[model samples]
Target: MSADRATTETAGLMDRMYRHQRHIYDASRKFYLLGRDQLIAELDPPPAGSILEIGCGTGRNLIKLARTYPDTQCYGLDVSAEMLATAGRSVARSGLSERIHLAQADATCFDAAALFGRDGFDRIVISYALSMIPPWRGVIAQALRTLTATGSLHIVDFGDQRGLPASFRVLLNRWLTLFHVTPRHDLPEAIAELSRIEGAESRTRRLLRGYAIHAVATRRAA
Candidate 1:
């Protein structure tokens, strides 16, 4: 499929999947979505910095991050209009609508300047969304393009679970499939190669016996 067509289908699938799930996504996933709060706590943005979340579903993370760092500006994009609608209401309820901006766009090829009127951001995060995005590597590349010289990118997602019991891994993957999630086993090597080519550096840490992975990559000054 052409890029545009693929994006359209991705959006459709996301909307269909989250139309109702968005309401209970947080409560249900909190048990398995490990390392999210740790990633947010470590996102130490620069003074008055700008932060963006590529797939900011339900605006949960964005809202928490905003409250964590009141001096920063927050922006988010998600392909699902259904999720964005829920996110908007959540943000308004948190009384953070003024500090948070939301937009509907595909994460794989978004134009930051056009969407948020900024060339780049000081911090960017992707929280457990990569496994659901078919073109996850493309989304990572596009997100890197919006990183300022000193900016950093953070990602936390399902890991290979190699350190866990074989039976557990099997059951986890099987259950995750219901949500269209496929853990990217090669995430470490992929980001290492991407960072090398981009003149950046990255490191990933496995959490909970590889149940989740967290990465932090920083680009050198130009």
Candidate 2:
């Protein structure tokens, strides 16, 4: 399927599933959404710069980021209106409505310029979101394109569980599959290829025996 068509379909499915679930999304996702704090720690945003987050469900990360980097402007985009609605409420409650911007847009092929009235972001993050996205690779590519000259992209998602017990891995995979989340088995290779194409510096590390965190690829300033 074409990129646009795939985006449409995925958005439709997410909207259907999250229409009601968004109310309790942040409360429920805390259990299994691992490595998010680590990703946030590595965010190191520049002072007075702009940050964007794709697939930002419920704006949990954005809240933390906004609190951490009060000097930076934060933006989050998601494909589901249900998710954005919750995000909106979170931003309002946190009183970060001015610093953080939330929008409903396809992460894979969204036009940042059109959506945000800007061309690029200084830092972009994708945290454990790739697994639920069907065209995740395209999302990464689009993120790269949306980066400023000195911008960086950060990602954290499920790993291959290479170090975890066989039984645990089996059960975890089974549970994640029910939510349409699949650990991309070839994530390392994919990140390597992305770095090569962008001619950007990349670093990857396995955390917790690859049961949770995988690799972090960064394209340093050119």
Candidate 3:
């Protein structure tokens, strides 16, 4: 399929999946979607810098980032209109409409400058979104292109459950399949390769016995 067609289809699928799920997403996801808050805690954007979240579902993480770093501006992009609608309402409810900006765009291929009137961001985050995106590597590369020279990209997502019980891993994978989420077992190696090619520094941490993975890739100096 063409890129646009694929994006549209994915967006439709996500909307159908989250049309109702977005309402209670944050409340229920708090259980299994681990390491997200930790990733937010590690986000140290530059003073008055800009932060962007690639798949800012329901604007949950973006709201947290804005409240945590009041000095920084926050931007979010999600392919699903249904989710963005919920996110918009959440941002408005938080009275952060002035500081947080959101747009509907495919994470794998978005024009940041055109969408948000910015060239790059100081800190970019992808929290648990990679597991659902079909072209996750492309999304990571696109995020790298949207980073400032000194910026860092942070990611937290489902892991391979290597340290967990075999039965648990099987059950977890089955549960995740219902949401169309697939743990990218090669994520660490992919990040390493991308960082190497871009002259960036990369780090990975396994959490909760490989139930989740956290990664950071900082761009190199020119």
Candidate 4:
């Protein structure tokens, strides 16, 4: 299928899935969605720089980012209209509508210039979204392409759970399947390969007994 059609279909599916779930997403996800706040804290955007979050569900991270880095501009893109609606409301409630902009687009193939009137971002974050995207590698490549020189891309997602108990891993995998989420066991390898090809600096850490992985890749100096 064409990229547009695929994006539309994926958007529809996400909207259907989160039409109501968006309400309690943050509250419930707080338990297992580890390292998100760490990722946010580590995001030290340059003064007056721009930041974007792919698959910014409910705008929770964007709101925090706006509050934490008052000088930086924040933007977000999500395929789900339903989630965006919730995110918009959240941003407005947080009184950050002026600093935070949001749009609906596929993370794998979005035009940052058209959506946010910029060709690149100083900081881009993908939090727990890659595992759910079918074309996650494409998303990584796109993010790298849109990263400004000296910019960084941050990612946090489910790990292989190698350190977790076997029974727990089995149960978690089964639960994730219901939500259409898959842990990318090869994520570290993918990051290394991409960083090598793009001539960027890459770092990754496995946290919570290998339950989650956090990664950062910075653009190479020109």
Candidate 5:
């Protein structure tokens, strides 16, 4: 399928899956989506900088980001219109419509310049999203290209569960599969390769004994 068609189909699928789930997504996900708060805390975007979140379901992270970094501009994009609708309402309810801008776009093909009138972002965050996306590597490349010269990319997602018990891993994977999530086993290597190709420095940490992977890649492009 073509990229546009694939994006459209994926959006439809997500909308169907989260049409009702979006209402309680943040609340339910808070329990198992570990390392998200850590990623947000470590963002440390520069003063008056810009932060963008890909696959920003329900705009939960964007709202938190705006509150955390009041001096910065925050933006988010999610393919599912249903999720964006909830996100829009949530942002407005929080009185952050001005500070938090949102759009409906696919992470793999979104244009930051077109969506947010910005060429690049100072900080890009992806929290627990890669596992649910099939073309996750492409999303990483797209995010790197959307980063400013001195920008950084932060990511947190389900890890390989190497440190956890084998039975636990099996059970967890089964549970995750029910939600269309598949942990990226080669996440660290993928980040290293992409960051190197983009002239960035990348580091990854295995958190919760490999239950989650937290990665940060900083660019020093001239």
Candidate 6:
């Protein structure tokens, strides 16, 4: 499918999926959305820097990052209005409405300069959002293109259940399928290809039996 069509489709899916789920999103998602805190803990944005989160659902990670690095400006973009509504409220409740900027845009093709008045960010993070996105690899490339020369991008998402028992893997995958989440088994290879093209470096770890936390894709200096 074309990028525009894919974006429309995904936006529709998200709108439908989260229209009601947004009300209880944070409450229910906290239980299974692992690796987010770890991603925040590991983010070390430069002093008085800028950070952006692609697929920043509910503004959760950006809120945490703003609190953790109060001096750094934070930005977020997502395709779903339903999700952004909750995100806006969350940012306000955290009293970070001024510190963080949220936008409704497709992660794969958004113009960072147009969205946030800049072409690059010091740090970029993507939580467990890639699995549900059909053009996620394009999102990674767009994200890399928007990174400062020395900035890094971090991503944590569902992984192949390579470490789990067959029965458990079957059950888990089935349950996740109900939510339209697919554990990308080829993620490491995708990252490797991206590294070669963008001169970025990546490291990934399997958590909870092959669920993955991938981080710190640093762009090479010019």
TM-scores for all predictions: 0.98, 0.95, 0.98, 0.98, 0.98, 0.95
lDDT (Cα atoms) of all candidates against the true structure: 0.93, 0.85, 0.95, 0.94, 0.93, 0.87
- Model 4 lDDT on a 0 to 1 scale: 0.94
Candidate 2 residue-wise lDDT, 70-164, digit = tens: 89999999988878888899899999999999888888778888889889998899988989887789888888878888888888888878899
Q: What RMSD, rounded to one decimal, does every model reach?
A: 0.8, 1.4, 0.7, 0.8, 0.8, 1.3
lDDT of 3 by residue, 1-222 (tens): 898999999999999999999999999999999999999998989999999999999999999999999999999999999999999999999999999999999998899999999999999999999999988999888888889999999999998799999999999899999999999999999998988877788999899999999999999988
Candidate 5's error at 65, in angstroms? 0.6
Stretches of candidate 3 above 4 Å error?
Answer: none
Cα lDDT of model 5 by residue, 1-222, tens digit? 899999999999999999999888998999999988888888889989999999899998999999999999999999999999999999999999989999999898888888999999999999888998999999999999999999999999999889999999999999999989999989999999999999999999999999999999999768
After superposition, the stretches of candidate 6 with alpha carbons farther than 4 Å from their true spots are none
Q: In model 5, where do residues sit more than 4 Å from their true spots?
A: none
Candidate 6: give the clashing pairs.
Answer: none
Off by over 4 Å in 2: none
Q: Is candidate 2 or candidate 4 better by TM-score?
A: 4
- Kindly give the stretch of ten consecutive residues in candidate 5 with the minimal lDDT sum: 35-44
Error of 2 at 183 (Å): 0.6
TM-score of 1: 0.98
- Candidate 6, residues 1-222: lDDT per residue as tens digits? 787888888888999999998888888888878888888888988999999999888887889899999999999999998899899999999998888999999998999888889889999999988888877798888888889989999888877878878998889788889989987888878887887789888877777777665656888778
Which candidate number would show the highest lDDT if scored against the true structure? 3
| Candidate 2 lDDT score at position 181 | 90
